[model samples]
Target: MLPSTDALLDGLLDWVRIETHTPDTAGLNSIMDLVQSQAEGFGATCQRFPGRDGKGDHLLVLSPWGDHAQKGVLLLSHLDTVHPRGTIEHDLPIRIEEDRCFGPGICDMKGGAFNGLAAMRAIAESGVTPPLPARILFTSDEEVGSPTSRSLIEDQGKHAKYALVTEPARNGGHVVTARKGVGRFTLKVEGRPSHAGARHWQGRSAVTELAHQIIALEAMTDYDREITVNVGEITGGTGTNVVPQFAQAEIDLRVPTAEAADEMVARITGLTPKTPDTKLTITGGMNRPPFEQSDASKALFDHASTLAAEIGFELVGEKTGGGSDGNFIADRIPTLDGLGPDGDDVHTLNEHIFVSSLKPRMLLLKRLMETLS
Candidate 1:
């Protein structure tokens, strides 16, 4: 049997209290320690890889049942959150407000991770062996993009037949079947600098060149094609009295298809400086490939939807603009994302999960583990 809602909330709240910011290695390991202990207590063997490149450690826990050599379920969750260290103490405290439980990292995915473990624990206690073995990989860096853990996740994906990401569910319990590819780039403009008052004609303003380029970049957004290019950050100029010699803008790109990603990348990278004598440089490329819906993924969603209905709820699949690690393995294998608890206000001061969703979502995950072959 699944645990009571109150009991599950108690376990999940314990995790919310820990501030595991993406860069806080110690905080991340603290939560991972708890994860390892709980997973091992339920007969899962865990492998701990130390953090590198100023990131937190990652935990890989394999189910006690099934052969270690077999290709099985890959359960993914990131322990690191975007919230800072003192978010809980100052901003979003652990409190039950009506049906929502507000806390730092509660909905954005610590809740999902905890409930996943709870489902496994229930299975272990009931003496039921899953049809296929399960491996839960708790990663540390995902909020700032999985810089250090991406390779590790892909390596693990090679041995897995199915990938289920416990990212926060969307649009009221909708699992993600597709996501836009994400790309980041930096555009730098270099120009001749001179005193604005003394030699305005001789100097080329890097900031002015950057402004023109920004307009061109923003104009690339095509809602019809589901492509967006945003120049999110810009830095330029040294003083008001001097013409700027250098300017830089950070660009964000999203596309719904691989072809769109390639096309947009070429367009962005091939930009030529409009201002004569000013040098323009572009750096960076696609970080995640688009997660297009596939037949296998559709079948997986159908199965999950059936399970959700049996558990007394309807589950839907959505295509989101946000990218997840699901993008990494969706093309490689059958992948279903946003299996986490239903919630709203993710990555905000009011971030929380619906307390009522705890039991049903847990039941759904438990059933998937038992029934997915």
Candidate 2:
């Protein structure tokens, strides 16, 4: 039996009350405890992997019927949000306004996580063991690039035949079949320092060189190929009196394919300093590979489309420039993403999910889990 709206709302509200900011491992651990208890209530055995690099640990919940040989479905989600601990109390309070539920992280992910849990419970109550076993992975560092959870996500992706990411549905109820690869690079320039007023001509301005590099980097953006480069942050110079001896630029890169990622990295690294006295060095490369559309992914989308129609909602797939752990898993498996409920104003004080979407999306998830192999 599917959980009632009151029951679902109560649960979601409870979850939204607890804030699991990306850097708050202790808070994340508390929420994971709640999620573990919920999953275990549905007969899923929970496993914990300790977090690294000061992030919260990860939880893997395996359904009672899961077996080593099944190579089943992987349901992916994250517990961390971009909001800090006090947002719930200060900026975004828990409130139900007409058809929407307002709170931080409510639309960004907690609502999706709640719906997913509800679907699992419905499955358990239905007495139908799915043809494909299921593993639900709740990661803790996704808001900050998923540094600790990437390897674990990939390892599970290798075992699963299909992956469904419960990220919030995009605007207009579109699911994601593709996501751009995301990466970061830092360029540092070392130059000779001299007194600004006394020996300006003797000094090599690292800031000047970095400014030139930023222009060059920004020019690398190719809208036609869906490639973009941004020099998002830069810092240099000690004081007004000093000609900076060192400067650095932090760049953000996005690409539509692995080949594009490689080519962009090469281009960035191959940059030659126009200034004679400065030496430049580059660091960092691609983080997540692009989730390009594949035949297998398209077939998966077709399966989901039929299931959505049976559930009485039209479904469509979209491509996005943003990257997620979905990007990490898609390169290895047939991944279907954005299966979460509809929402708007994600990652803001106005963040909210459609209250009306909870049950239908839950039912849709239940049907897909029950029917998909």
Candidate 3:
């Protein structure tokens, strides 16, 4: 029998009370405490991976009963919530009103994490320990792109035959099949400075040179290939009277292909100085690798769909513009994501999770573990 929805809901409320925003060390620790306490009850072994000190931390829990070399799944979810420190701590009450459960981090991840534990428990009680293991990794920095935890995810991902991510599905519960690769770029332009009024002819404007670069950068965006170049932030001149000596701007680029990522980085980094009077510098590279759907991923998706069908949910796939830790692991192994409870308005004050969706979704996940045998 599957675990009760009441127990899953209680566990979700327990997790949401922790307030694990990445920049808050205390919050991260609180989340780790919550995770460890919960996992320990089931005889699972928990480990803490200290993030760059003062930058928060991540937690990993391995159920002692499964084996990886045989054929199991790797479960991934983030512990960190985007909420500011102390804002949601002990304040976001878990409520079931009509169709949804209202609370911070409930659908985004905490609810999903609880479901993973529940699924394992269901497996254990069924007296069917699969030949493969299901490894759960809950990172604290996924809200900020998992910079410190991607490597670890990839490392564990390669060992598992399948990967299941617990990120809320988009378009009303359609799972994710593909996502774009992301990159960051910095543009620095330097030029000769002179009094704007006095030696105007001898002066070269760095900001003026930057304008040309920005235009060139924007033109590089190819909508046909789903590539975009955005100069998001800029800063420059110190005084209105003086010619600016330095100007800098940050560029965000996204591509659908790995080769496109390489091409974009090379071209953006090599932007020639517009004027001999200006020197330019560009830095930053690909962050999240593009998730190109492959055979392995398709197989896992098929399996998840089968599980969802048993629980009366028709599974469908969708493409996402946003990146997730799923992209980090998918490239290395068979990965399936967007399997968590449905929700909307993430990163906003109105964030919410579907109460009705929890039981069905949790049941599907519960079977995902039991069927592993």
Best by lDDT: 1
Model 3 has an lDDT value of: 0.80
- For 1-373, candidate 2 gives per-residue lDDT tens digits of 5688778888988888889999988889999999999899878899999888899989998877757467988889898999998998889998888998899898778877778777877888778888888888999998888889999999988779988888988877889999999988999999889999999999999999998999999999999999999999899999999999999999999999999998999999999998888999999988888899888989989998999898888898999998888898786688888888799999889999888777777777777788778
Q: Residue pairs in steric clash, candidate 1?
A: none
lDDT against the true structure, per candidate, is: 0.92, 0.88, 0.80
How high is each candidate's TM-score?
A: 0.99, 0.97, 0.92
Poorest stretch of ten by lDDT in candidate 1: 61-70
Q: What is the lDDT of residue 234 in candidate 1?
A: 99
Ranking by TM-score: 1, 2, 3
Tell me the tens digit of each residue's lDDT in model 3 across 201-236.
888899999999999999999999999999999999
Please, what are the lDDT tens digits per residue for candidate 1 over residues 96-158?
A: 889999999999898888888888889888899888888888999999889999998999998
How high a TM-score does candidate 2 get? 0.97
Relative to the true structure, candidate 1 reaches a TM of 0.99
